[model samples]
Target: MIQQVFSIVVPLFVIAAVGYFYGSRVRPEMRITNQLIMDVFMPALIFHVMIQEDFYPSQYLPIMLAGVLLMLGSGVIAFGLARLIHLPWRGFVPPAMFSNWANLGLPLYVFSLGDAALGAGVMLVVAGNILCFTIGTYIYSGKLSSLEVLKTPVIVAVILGGAFNFLDIRLPLAFDKSVEMLGQIAIPLMLFSLGVRLTRASWKDSRAGVIMAMFCPMVGVALALLLIELIPMSAMHQNILILFGALPPAVVNFILAEQYQTEPDAVASMVLIGNFFAVISLPVVLFFVLSN
Candidate 1:
């Protein structure tokens, strides 16, 4: 397990580190590349994942409940904590609620569990996406937009991808080939872009806020593990859920923060803080859960 995790995390991180270095060396270029990855490359990748996987809707019911409950529970708990700390509504909600479902969870699902697990994980992401675009956006921006929710990339990806998968409809060979090529770029590009994005973040700034952000995910980790144990999930799926809960704040949070005029910097800081802690926190949490 140790080696498996190391192998999975090491290369992506190494590449991301290199990307950070290059991004630092070339600022504007990196920004453009980040935008491109987020805007175009990522959507293609998501579409591919959505379309290719065979989703088992019945098997996913409990997992879906777990995901949604964690989101809502964590959101309220984190929001309360943030409020206690006197964080503004803008800064308070994003880190508190957003689980790093994208940059972290998806890849970990692919690596740790393989195809079927990845399919289940995709369902989880789809649910997360709906919450993010609709409720999450409202919480962050202090405004409502049903139209934007329907238009969100992740939502669209889920709906369209499900349609394609269920209908057994295949894309044209040419378009499928194109999407595959572009989709392959998603992980590397996003990780690199994340690295580039981190360049502007001060690792030391917002220490208190960062610490506070870690608190909720810890609670979430405990809750998730307990639920897995009590709820009768398969051992492997339980492991996945525990790890998913252990994941750092969602990258989507920071993106939404920027999009909706939330506290982008604070959200970024929470991600940085949560990720730093995750290296130690996840393994220990996993050890405990698995041992149990």
Candidate 2:
């Protein structure tokens, strides 16, 4: 078990560590790279997975529902916590609600659980992206639009991909291979960009950040445990849900915070500190998950 844990965890952190070293030393401009990731690489990855001949959307519906419920459950708890602590709902709730699924989740699941689990993991990410763009955007910007959600590249990829899967239409091998190659770039770039983002993070709101850093995952895992008791799912889905619950706040949380001017400092602290805490938290979750 220890060896399995190390095998899964070590490579991820080593790549991230290299990114951190490069980011701190080189401080390369990441805006274009980040845009390309969101607009192209990630969508290609999602589309590639969704359009695979073996891909069956219905098989993973439970996991997708679990992901939605997890986010909503976390949001409810975060709302209560925000009111209790006198923190702005916009500042605390979104980060608490959205986990770092895209960056940490895809690679972690693919590495630890193997290729069979990748579709389920991608489904979880798609579910999160839907909510993050619509409901989560509403929380930050005070408006929601179906058109706005549809305009997102990842959302478009998911919709089209699901359609192709549902209709059992496989793309030609040459085209499919091309898309797969583009998709493959996303995971490593995601980990590397994560490290770059971390280098720019500040520790201004350490106290509140620390509290939220712990609070976010606690609420998620607790809700996941309760949901697993009530919901009958496959072992793979259960493991994915638990790991999803254990994930830290999304780095996009800080991006949105900065964009909307909604306590970016506190959000940044929560994002950075929460991720740092994941170094300890993820292994514990993995131990329990793998034991099962």
Candidate 3:
């Protein structure tokens, strides 16, 4: 059990650590890299995975619905908590609602649940990304953000990939390989970028960060438990949703905060600390899910 847990986690940390140390010494600029990821690599990955020969959107509808409930439930809970604690809702709620489905989640699910689970993981990510880009962005910047969501590359990819899957359209073999290769770059790059982004977090905001680091997973898991009882699903999906609920905040939360000039520092703190804390949270989650 311990070995399995370590195998899933160690590689992610080691790769992120490489980014952390490199960023510390070189202070490399990441704007262009992040742009490329959002505009090119991540979209490619989403399309490649969704357009796979065996992929079926209908098969994962239960998981997809559960994922939506988990995100919306977390946001509601986080909203009440934010008001109770007087934390800026703008800074706190987004990270609390959107888990690190890409950076920590994709590989984590693959390693822990095996490659067969990748499609489920991808479905969960697509659900969260849709919410994050639409509702999450709206929360940060009001109504105008609606149009922006339409233009987001991730959302665009989801629409196109899902369309291709539904229509039974297949890319030519060589073109398919190219997209797969490009898609392959998204996950590792996401983890490394997470490390680089952590370097800029303000420890002074660690109090709120710590609060969220603990709060996010608890709310998510609670919601997941409730939803699973309400929604019948396969054991594999039940476990996948449970782990998804336990994931840390998405690193993109901080990116969006920065983009909107919200309390970017506070968001960064939550993202950095929440992920650092996941080293503890995830293993416990694994023990629970795997034991059952």
* Candidate with maximal lDDT: 2
lDDT of 1 by residue, 54-152 (tens): 554567778878888777877787777767867775676656666767666766667656655666676777778778877888888888787887775
Tens digits of per-residue lDDT, candidate 3, 1-292, equal 7787788788988888888888888889998998998899988988998999888888899999999988988888899999999999988888989998887888788878887788899888878888898898887766445576668888899899989988999999999999999988988998898788778766679888999889977888889889999998888898889999999988788878888888988988898889889988988888888878
- TM-score to native of every candidate shown: 0.85, 0.97, 0.95
lDDT of 2 by residue, 68-186 (tens): 99899899988998899888878899988898898998888888788888899988888898899888888887778767878989988998998998888988999999999999999
lDDT of each: 0.70, 0.87, 0.87
Let me know the TM-score candidate 1 reaches against the reference structure.
0.85
Among these predicted structures, which one has the highest TM-score? 2
